[model samples]
Target: MKIAVIDGQGGGLGKTIIEKIRRELGNTVEIFALGTNAYATASMVKAGANDGASGESAICFCCKNVKFHCIIGPIGIICPNSMLGELTPSIAEAVFNADCIKYLIPISKHGLYIPGVQHMQINDFIQEIILELKKKLTH
Candidate 1:
C-alpha cells in the first residue's frame, strides 16, 4: 500500500504518523512525506518516511501524479490558507482532487473545530488512525 503523510509547521504530526506507520506496518507500506516546507519534510524523513518532498509545488506535483492509497494529515491540508497560509489554494486543490482516500486528523486550528470529534490525546488519535489503516489494507 502507498500512503502520503502531508504536514507543515514543524512537521511533528507528520513525523508521528510516519513513525507509527513504520512501526505497525513495517515495510508493507510505502510512506511519502509531503511537507509545505523543507524543515517539515526533513523532520518526517528522519522519522521514517520512505521518501519526502517539500513546498507547495512539490505537494501539487506529487498529489497529481502519484496514486496514493490514502493521504493522511491534519485537516489543514485541505483548508486553503491554513498552516499560517503555508497551505495555498493550489496545494489544497491538488490534494482534494487527488484520486485517493483522505484520512485527516481533526485538529482544531484557527478556531476551526470538527463536529463530533471527541477530546482525546494525540496517542489515542494515532491509534485510531492505525486501526483504520490496518482495516483498509487487510480488506
Candidate 2:
C-alpha cells in the first residue's frame, strides 16, 4: 500500500509519523513524504520515507493527479489556511476530493499556535490507522 505523509514548516510531525510507520510496518508499505518545503521533505526522508517531494505545486500535483491508497497527516494538511504556501484551498480540495481514505490526526485551533513542535501523539494515531489498514488489506 502507498501512504502519503504531508507536512509543512519544519516537518517535525511528518518525521515522527514516518519513523513510526517504518518501525512498525517495515518494508511492507510505501511511504511518500509530501512537504510544503524542502526541509519538511528532507526531515521525512531522513525518517525513512521511500520518496519525498516538496512545494505547493508538488503537493497540488500529487493530490490531484496521483493515485494513493491513503493520505495521512494532521488536520492542518487539509486546512488550507494554516501553513504558509503549503496549505491552500486548492490543495485541500484536491485531497478531500481524492478517491482515497484519509487519516487526520486531531488538531485543535490552539494547537496551531505551537510552532516547531507537534502537540499531539501522532504515533498512537498512526498505529491505529496502520492497524485498520492492515485489517483492510488482509481482508
Candidate 3:
C-alpha cells in the first residue's frame, strides 16, 4: 500500500507521522511525503518517507497520478488558504479530488473548531492513525 503524508509550515507533523508509520508498519507500506515547501519535504524524508516532493505542482501531479491507498495529513490540507497560504487553492482542490481515502488530524487552528473532537496530543492522534491503518491494511 502507498500512503501520502502531506504537511506544510515546519513539517513537524508530517515528520512525526512518517516516523511512527515506519516504526509500526515496517516496510509494509510505501510512504510519500508531500509538502508545500522544500524544508517540509526534507523533514519528512529524514524521518523515513520512501520519497517526497514539494510545491503545489508536485502536490497536484501526485494527487492526480499516484494511486495512493490513503492520504494522511492535517485537516488544513483540504482547506483553501491554509498553512499561512502555503497550501494553495490548487493543492487543496487536488487533495480533495484525489482518488484515495483521507485521514485528517484535526488541529486547533485559529477560527477552526472540529466539533466533537477533543483536543489531544499529537502522539495520541498518531497512535489512532496507526491503529486504523493496522485494521485496514491487515485485512
Candidate 4:
C-alpha cells in the first residue's frame, strides 16, 4: 500500500515515524515523504521513504492526484498556516480535501493542544500507528 508521510520544518517527527515504519514493516509498504521544504523531505528520504516531494504545489498536486492508502502527519497538516507558517492555506486545504484516510499525530505545539494526547509520549503514538497499519496490512 502507498502511504504518505507529510511533515514540515525540520522533519524530526517524520524521520522518526519513517524509521519505525521501516523497522516494523520492512519493505512491504510504499512510503512517500511529503515535506514543506527540501530539507524536510531529504530528512525523511534518508530515513527510508521510498520516494519524496516538497513544497506547497507538490503537496497539493499529490494529494489531489495520487491515491495513497492513507496520509499520516501532525495535526497541523490540516490547519492552514500551521507548521510555523510553513504550511500554506492551499496545502492544508488539499490535504484536508484529499480522498484518503488521515492519521494525525496529536502535537501540542504551535499553540495547539489535544486533550488526552498531552499525556502520551510521541513514541507511543508512532507505535500505535505502526501497529494499526500492520494489522490492516495483514488483513
Candidate 5:
C-alpha cells in the first residue's frame, strides 16, 4: 500500500506520524512525505518516509497523478490559505478531490473545527490513525 503524509510549517506533526507508522507497519507500505516546503519535507524524510516531495506544484501533482491508497495529515490540508498561507487554493482543491481515503487529524490553525472531533492528545490521535490504517491494510 502507498500512503502520503501531508503537512506544512515545520513538519513536526508529519515527522511524528511517519515515525509511528514506521514502527507499526515497518516498510510494508510505502510512505510519501508531501510537504508544503523544503524544511517540512526534509523533516519527514529524516523520520522514515520512503519518499519525499515539497512545494505547491509537487503536492498538487501528487494529489492528482499519484495513486495513493490513502492520505494522512491535519484537517487543514483541505483548507485553502491554511498553514499560514502555504496551502494554495489549487492544492486544497486537488487534495479534497483526490481519489483516496483521507485520514485527517482534526487540527486547524485558523479557527476551523470539526464539531464531532473529541478532545484528545495529539499522540492519542496519531495512535488511533495507526490502528485504523492497520485494519485497512490487512483487508
Candidate 6:
C-alpha cells in the first residue's frame, strides 16, 4: 500500500513516524514523505522514506494526483492555517475533500500553542495508527 506522511516545521515528527512505519511494516509498504518545506521532506527521507517531496506546489500536486491509500499526519496537516504553510486553504481543502483515507493525530487546544514538542507521544500514537491500518488492510 502507498502511504503519505505529511508534516511541517522541523519535520522531526514526520521523520519519527517514517522510521516507525519502516521498522514495523518493512518493505511491504511504500512511504511517501510530503512536507511543507525541504527540511521536513529531507528529515523523512533520512529516516528511510521510499520517496520525498516538499513545498506548497509539491503538496498540492501530491494531494491532487497521488493515489495514496492513506495520508497519515497530525491535525495540523488538515488545518491550512496551522503548520502546513503555503499548502494552505486550497491544498488542505483538496486533501480533506479527496477520497483517500486520513489518519490524523488529535492535538488539544493548548497543545497547539507549544512549539517543538507535540501534544502527546507521537511514537505511541503512530504505532496505534499503524496497527489499526494493518488490521484494516488485512481484513
Best model number under lDDT: 4
Of candidate 1, the 10-residue stretch with the lowest lDDT total is 110-119
Q: List, residue by residue over 1-139, the lDDT tens digit for candidate 6.
A: 8899988878888898889888888888899999888998999999989999988788888888989888988777777767735448766886796568998776654136555445567677888888987886687
Give model 5 RMSD, 1 decimal: 1.1
Candidate 2's residue-wise lDDT over 37-117, tens digit each? Answer: 899999999999999998878888888777889998887777766675467777787778878998887765524554443
**CA lDDT, every prediction?**
0.92, 0.82, 0.94, 0.94, 0.92, 0.81
Compared with the true structure, the alpha-carbon lDDT of candidate 5 equals 0.92
Local accuracy of candidate 5 as per-residue lDDT tens digits, 1-139: 9999999999999999999999999998999999999999999999999999999999999999999999999988998998999988988999999999898888745687667666787888899988988998889
- lDDT per residue as tens, model 3, 1-139: 9999999989999999999999999999999999999999999999999999999999999999999999999999999999999989999999999998999999888358877778688788889999999998879
Which residue pairs collide, candidate 6?
A: none
In angstroms, give how far residue 3 of model 4 lies from its true place: 0.4
Write candidate 1's Cα lDDT for 22-133 as tens digits. Answer: 9999998999999999999999999999899999999999999999999999988999999999999999999999999898888878568777776777777878989988
For each predicted model, how many residue pairs clash, with residues at least 3 apart or on different chains? 0, 0, 0, 0, 0, 0
Number of the top candidate by TM-score?
4
Query: TM-score of every model?
Result: 0.95, 0.86, 0.96, 0.97, 0.95, 0.85
Sorted on lDDT, best first, the list reads 4, 3, 5, 1, 2, 6
Tens digit of per-residue lDDT, candidate 4, span 29-73: 999999999999999999999999999999999999999989999
Query: Candidate 3, which segments miss by more than 4 Å at Cα?
Result: none
Q: How accurate is candidate 6 locally (lDDT)?
A: 0.81
RMSD of each: 1.1, 4.2, 1.0, 0.8, 1.1, 3.8
Model 1 RMSD to the real structure? 1.1
Local lDDT at 2 for model 6: 89
List the candidate 1 regions with Cα displacement exceeding 4 Å. none
Candidate 4 ranges beyond 4 A from true positions = none
**Candidate 4, lDDT over the whole model:** 0.94
| Model 4, backbone clash pairs (residues 3+ apart or across chains), number | 0
